[model samples]
Target: MFSTRKMWLIFLLYLFPYANTAQDIIFGQNKFTEYQIGNMSLIITVPHGGSKQPSTIPSRDCGCWDMSSSKCFFTHNCPPGTIKDSINCKVSTVKDLYTLETALNLGKEIQKITGGYHPHIIINHLSRSKLDVNREKDEATFGVPEAEQAWDEFMQFINTAKSYSPKGLLIDVHGHAHPENWIELGYLISKQNLDSGAFTAADSSILFLSKESYNIPFETLLRGDRSLGNNIQEQNKKYLCVPSPTHPGPSGGNYFKGGYIVKTHGSKDNGQVDAVQIELPRWIRDSSERPIFCAALAKAISNFYNFHFK
Candidate 1:
């Protein structure tokens, strides 16, 4: 019997003879999503930087739709200009500004670093008000047929990319406007758990990495000398990442542990693929800083992958 990894490879070889072929595939209305095929064993997904907003599909609201009342009520406010006929509840409509550009450039930097090995990039171009591909289906599309179609196309593309690499990393790129200017490298460990030291390998998005008997402690892999945070910091001191040696934990500040992307795509027990949610601050993602930071990030990613997966 073939090993699971081998079996997966065989399956992919059968299903996609051109899985390694590099090309751009666009989906959804007005081509709101795209998948850039590449040769590297890496995939980058940008779910929140979508810009298209087709009025044919209503914006997703708080998701607490009231059938009888014909209204949706939730703690958050709906997108701007939403009327009563619309689900007028709060949903995060703010785009992750510049994340798409950052992802695309990061792919190029990775290609340069790897001598033309491109990282597969999946980009969602729909506005967050229309669809939040990171969230579950119901919350993402609010039953809008058009939005739902886009979500399916976006997610299927990620799965397809994963199929090409039995072992790889999925970097879910995002941006944050938090008070702190440091980067947030989320492995699905919450701030509370990180602060209290109450989390374990089971709680990690990169559980596959934790399961490896690398003779290295899990804590070290998380925030010690061997962590991605440390690697990125080593590449550039200006870009500090949380859960690194310098910032071991949130310390009771604003932070995002991770979101649906990492939690869903990250490997489980003994799984080959691992994922990390990278939330960058405006400083790092801004046009002036992006190219330099992408270089640093590509180096860090190459180093981390070599150290762990190679």
Candidate 2:
């Protein structure tokens, strides 16, 4: 006799109490594939840190994989490394150069900073050459059953985190090898769009948190003095970032400007959760230098969340 909406509410409240209480969930068949699902408002995803190649799943066949080929779907050029693998490849798609290490490093430090409190950390541990979790389902999974299951689990993990907290931040961490060593933050607005002065809240990735949840102006939180960029700057002034509220977009060459994953999972939807895609450079990902960088970045995120997201 209950209405559909009421019934759904009851389902979420009592029938799915485990969904609300479970703090972590791990899904994978092997080391090459895995997803770490956490129960925090802050969601972090590293789509390309995997290195387990079974050769069971066929590597993706995309023109971008060919460096000499003229077919490139992504705005930013493919990064260096992962080229030695003989998978009939030219451009790199095997991995994102220490991205998984960076995510795990950041996650560990954040957990320490939060005093055992955990964040929703979702990682794709399969080699991109085997399965590109960041690409569209068709291109990402290539119709493979196993890879398709991974794709589903990744999105489901994000949705699960969103369900935990009505308002939170989701950051997709990636590695970039541009000539400049600056971090590229993607909020979905393109270089041309930002220059035209026509960019609006609807175009942003974190506009939901900026406008609706926090009741703060989108521009101010994006690049303002109280933004995530500022938090990172506080951690290390030597580090430089772009596309913040102040920078808007990259100055030259092709930039990431965000990707399929960020758009699909970010606050572009009507959800209260906001998201940002941070593209890290090798300088920060270096073994010796990574520890310090991760520590600082983790602290910055903690401070930012306490100030704005919490």
Q: Of the candidates shown, which would achieve the greatest TM-score relative to the real structure?
A: 1
Alpha-carbon deviation at 68 in model 2, angstroms: 24
Q: How well is each residue in 1-310 modelled by candidate 2, as lDDT tens digits?
A: 9854334344434522323224334454443334455535788888888777766777655433444553333212334522222344333475788888888889889989999767777778778876777777766765777778777767765676677677888889898888878887788878677556568778988777667545666666766667788788778787776755446556654567788777887878777777788988888998988999999999989998888777
Quick one: best lDDT, which candidate?
A: 1
Candidate 1 Cα outliers beyond 4 Å, as residue runs: 1-29, 65-89
Report lDDT (Cα) of residue 102, candidate 2.
89
- Over 85-186, each residue of candidate 1 has an lDDT whose tens digit, in order, gives 333445677899999999989989988888888888888899998989988777788777788888887887788788776788899999999898889999
Per-candidate TM-scores read: 0.85, 0.79
Whole-model lDDT per candidate:
0.81, 0.71
Model 1: how far is 197 from its true place, Å? 0.8
- 10 residues in a row with least lDDT, candidate 1: 74-83
* Cα lDDT for residue 149, candidate 1: 81
Candidate 2 regions with alpha-carbon error over 4 angstroms: 1-25, 37-39, 63-94, 213-215, 245-248
**Candidate 1, residue 301: lDDT:** 92
Predicted structure 1, TM vs. truth: 0.85
